[model samples]
Target: MTSPASSKRPLWIVAATLLLGAAALWGGSRLVWSAQQRDGGVRGMLLETQTGAQHSGALVPLAVLAVAGVAGAVATGGWPRRVLGVVLAVAGLWACWIAVDGVSFSGFPPGAPVWQMFLGRALTLLAGILVLLGGLIATKRAGAMPRLGARYAAPSVKKTARDPDTELWEALSEGEDPTDSA
Candidate 1:
């Protein structure tokens, strides 16, 4: 028998995964853009700083996360989905760490002011945490998908027609009031 809740699980997972992916993309693009705004360009400004390297490394993990999210949206069950979920979660954690470190490192220069550095770091940290949590939830939902899919994948139950309407009609025919305000 397919329970209504179980049947809806796949749709929910797909929707959640897609939403997470879209959010990550938006946040990531904004982070990169902000860094570019500070440095003037995406490719030329980051070779001299530790934060640059960390931020650069974030791209790969972000790619992995995007791919995994897309995959989860497209395919909700099986081992591939499980593997992707784990990868997405790990990537999310790594991204968070990089953001935190980058934010801290940005303030340690002779040119950069302390307030601006701290503010950038705080924003990065907040975004990182959001991405991390979203990825983690995506992972958890992926884990639940297989169980839900398996449960609902079972053969459907053929219910007998012992419906309330039929019973009511039979009661009325027998001179008994079916709707006696009971």
Candidate 2:
């Protein structure tokens, strides 16, 4: 039997997963591809260049987070769902660690403020958290909920006219005085 709440839960989970995936993708791109400017000239002229090697390495974790988000979003039921949840949680933690590490490394150009450097990593971390939450929610709900196919399944109830002998036996079993009643 399907309840309104049961049906709605997965939808919300999927939505959250998608949102997280998008955020991770966007943040990862920013962290990986965006360059910052540094003041080098007498008049405070700035030059734009790619981020340093330390920040560049963060891309791998962000990519893992993005993949986990998508996998968590699509996975359904049983061990598969549980596995995805675990994956999401681990990926989120990994991304968070990498992002936080990036914050401490003074790799970006001087003109880029600490907050600016942290923004993309922060978003990546946030996306990882969302993915982890969604995966766990889905796993917790999966056990109590029936599968999609179960909704269509119904016990085959065969209805037939009551037999005379069966009715008489039922009356006798109940200690009913059928003859006296007549």
| Number of the predicted model whose lDDT against the real structure is largest | 2
Candidate 2 lDDT, 1-182, residue by residue in tens: 78978776675665567466556645654653245665677857675634422455655555555555554445455676666667666665665565566355656555555564566666666665666566566556656533445554543663343997776675665568556756
Alpha-carbon RMSD, candidate 1: 10.5
lDDT per residue, candidate 1, 58-150, as tens digits? 544474455556556455565666566566666656655655653434434344344543444454445455445555555555545444346
lDDT of 2 at 98: 56
| Winner by TM-score | 2
Q: TM-score per candidate, in order? A: 0.46, 0.56
lDDT of 1 at 137: 53
Clash pairs, model 1 backbone: none
